[model samples]
Target: MTSFDIVFGSFLVSALRSATPLVFVLVGETLVQRTGSINLGVEGQMLVGAMAGYGAAALWGDPWLGLVAGAGAGMLLSSVHGLLTLAARANQFASGLAVWMLGFGLSAYYGAGLVGRKIEGFGTWRGAGLDDVPVLGPIVAGMTPTVLLALVVAPAVAWWFWRTRTGLVWRAVGESPEAARAAGLRPIRVRLQAILLGGLLSGLGGAALSVDHTRTWAEGMTAGRGLVAVGLVIVARWNPWWVLPTALLFGGAEALALRLQTADAGVSAHLLLTLPYITSLAVLTLTCLRDRGQAAPAGLRAVMDR
Candidate 1:
């Protein structure tokens, strides 16, 4: 391959890899927010998942088990948020923040023993023979299995939200709990389902980080990607279908930052590292200015209305 071709291909590949976790979190957050719940606890959820997944892989000698354990951890924490917000009628945002803190403390306290540890984590999926092809080969060849699964699942989630009877009920519950109750559907129950599912996905993303991306456990390894995903849901206008592109955009910024760090650019390395967060903030600001809550569910509006 030509030098430019190789460089561009590397950038594309890195973008996809970086975007994987965001895609997972964005999809999960979309599901939760659709049901009128804001999950700011994603940062903590991911951290706990990362620790649990890494510890599981280390203990049992299987990375896949780590994925499951991570998801379970996320669900366990999510249940607390659900109980507080849904059962006790607590403020969703506050409950989410509390969950985040709980997760942070729990993970930090428990994960101390796991620092500097390693596991036989997942490997990339190098499509057989495809790596010999032209540009497409380099760009699409070496993705990890979890990223591929996320790509497939994103569309499936979009389909489920738009093309099914159950999906309609889910939307109905989000749009108006009173109307859902009138229609004989329990809003609390549906929302709890959504929140729990979102937590599972978040945990899976965390597992992907520890098992498929970094292959090691570290305190606060998630580094606010969860919060970025929350902003991405907003930038996607709360549509599951739009999450993929939004996540890609953020991933591209991250990849570019890394690329700049390695290049001859005279920029400060720390400044380059800020690109992803800067991009997220810019997109969030622009989206809010343009949309002004138009994409938020009616149930969410009602919560604000109260």
Candidate 2:
């Protein structure tokens, strides 16, 4: 009824929409970090996935197939990193950066030419059942199905990381690679699996943003959500459970910025837009200082030499 109430209601929905990509990236990053491998090319991965996903969807008439193709693309890119980092014993940071740059070049080359190429018959989440709820309409609670999928995955990921036997091995590799080796587990193998899975999930995040959420292919559509999510993993102390809520918090700040701009409050839009990233930076810096010992993975180096 009131203008402020309407703005606040819209903000919540917008926050949820924005949070979906963050949740997807953080969950995947959570597993990779837990297994002692680091990838900084998430932005690149998402961009590539966006292009690949849209291309696949446009070809297949089924968005689900596009998502699968997108995920495969992500895994392929990450597998290269896993080989370089774990097998060749390359520096994780450097190798990850290389991957990022490679993706950057490839995406820009392809994305520019593909603009306005429509994907006919791609399913959209805009008019699902959620829009009918009196309190949970599009202005308040209507959300893309990808958001629901991500919310479900978050808890499942937390449970798997903390409670399963495979998870134990995953954690062991992160905490003590030598111990994991001595325990009859292959460090390379465990880390490879983690890397692949992480990349897959992240790619799905890209797919969701490109195909399901926006239903369009824009160059650099993912923006920097992937990188922010890497910080989210660090801020959550590598805890999958906590990553969900932290993502929501960051998303909320973003939603507020968008609302303020829409309301034309005379505030600079760029400043409001930077709030989420700024908040993530503050959280990461504070978490690093306050929970140094607890925040880092067992053997993770700030800069991996080998």
Candidate 3:
């Protein structure tokens, strides 16, 4: 009868799990945005990552290998985009959308026979002698590895963007590509690295959802989480540091909806599940009203921040 206790305790776990994927995706998007480009192919990239990770895991029967393969898969696809935009001088948005289409179509084709496939659980890793220190027991208990990574990555990403010289150049490229180039920083090269790293992070997010979260794979499993991550970039005002809390907000909503389903709220469950998307739109609408649609980074050339 203690609803508070139930939601408080279980919500933490659900939040951790649900937020893991979004954490990775948003952070990656933040990195890419820092370099002044947007990749709308996030949904498609994530879909391909899911298919690749599940397929690799299923075939090799080893989850770690599968995860690595998934990352590689995403990198390969994204590198192609980098080449087109960087080397070939193609329009960034158009090239990204093409990559998205390629990932979606390819993943769907290969995933046709893989739907409904099941995977073994990725259970918690209990700390051994040192990590079991009494003072820190609560800190690490019951946390999936990605959750820990999510926590640690906030500062790492910040350092990558602000403290490092490369980071400075990267931001410069985003804010003013021509200026960056005049300063002897190769815009295409920096952008390519940003794009590649973004793909890697996004791939990890897909792995968390399919392998760690549900332990299953299906067509369209990404379900627009990629798009949500892109939105997170805007909501966070293209700040890597802001992605953490914003990701949790989205994650918390999703966890609440799932919990409602477990409580057998039926129609209400479905409604709650749909709220995150609505919330995203609402957030955009509100931000636009205030900033007149300039919540995103200035000088960042991309398509469809709206």
Candidate 4:
């Protein structure tokens, strides 16, 4: 291939790698919001998952086990949010903030010693048969299993939301919890399930970051990706399918920043790093203005209106 082809192909690969984690978190948060609740603690959940996943992998010599640990850690943190919001009827925003703080503190304390540790994390797939198929083959071969999973998750969630009985009930609860309750559906139960599921996905996102992408642990490594996921969900208007492109947009910006930094393109390194966040903010702002909350779930509107 030509030099330009190689460069462009590399950029695409990097964008996919960076977008993988966001895809996971976006789907998870989408589910939670669909149930008329929000988990602002996604940041904390991701951190805790990262620490637990890396620590477990390091201790057990298995990345799969680390992934399980990460999911569990994220779910465990979400349970606190569920208790506060569902059972105690606490302010959702306040409860979510508390959950985030708790997660942040716990991960930092437990993961302090894990810094600089290394593990045999997930490796890229080998496109043995398709290696000669040009750009597509090379990109597919460069992806790890987690990247493939993230790609599947977005569409799977979209299908589940629109094509299943359970999904309809969840959507019903999100649109009007009182109506759902009167119709013999339990809103609290559904919301709790969504919260837990969301946490699991968030954890997986964190694990993908440390075990699949970085292959190492670091404090605050998530760097507000969780918050970015939250904004992307808004940009997507709660539609799982839209998440794919929006996430790729953020990922591509991040990849470009990294490429520029390495090429010493005469820009400040710190400024370059802000490209992802800047892209997210710009898209989110535009989406908000266009949507004007017209697409928000009614149940979520009630909670936010308070």
By lDDT, the best candidate is 4
TM-score of 1: 0.95
Q: Give one digit per residue, the lDDT tens place, for model 4 in 249-288.
A: 9889999999999999999999999999999999989988
* Candidate number that wins on lDDT, 1 or 3: 1
The positional error of residue 76 in candidate 2, measured at the CA in angstroms, is 1.0
lDDT of 2: 0.79
Q: Write the per-residue lDDT of candidate 1 for residues 117-177, one digit (tens) a residue.
A: 7788776647677777888787677777877877997899999999998888888988988
Best by TM-score: 4
* C-alpha RMSD between model 2 and the true structure: 2.7
Model 3 residue pairs with clashes:
none
Candidate order by TM-score, highest to lowest?
A: 4, 1, 2, 3
Give one digit per residue, the lDDT tens place, for model 2 in 49-137: 77788888888877878778777777777777788888898888788788777766777787776678777534334566645555445
True-structure RMSD for candidate 3: 3.3
Worst 10 residues of 4 by lDDT: 125-134
Higher-lDDT candidate of 1 and 4: 4
Model 2 misplaced regions, further than 4 Å: 1-9, 120-141, 301-306
How does model 2 score by TM-score?
0.89
**Window of ten residues with lowest summed lDDT in model 1:** 121-130
Q: Could you list the CA RMSD of all candidates, in the order they appear?
A: 1.6, 2.7, 3.3, 1.4
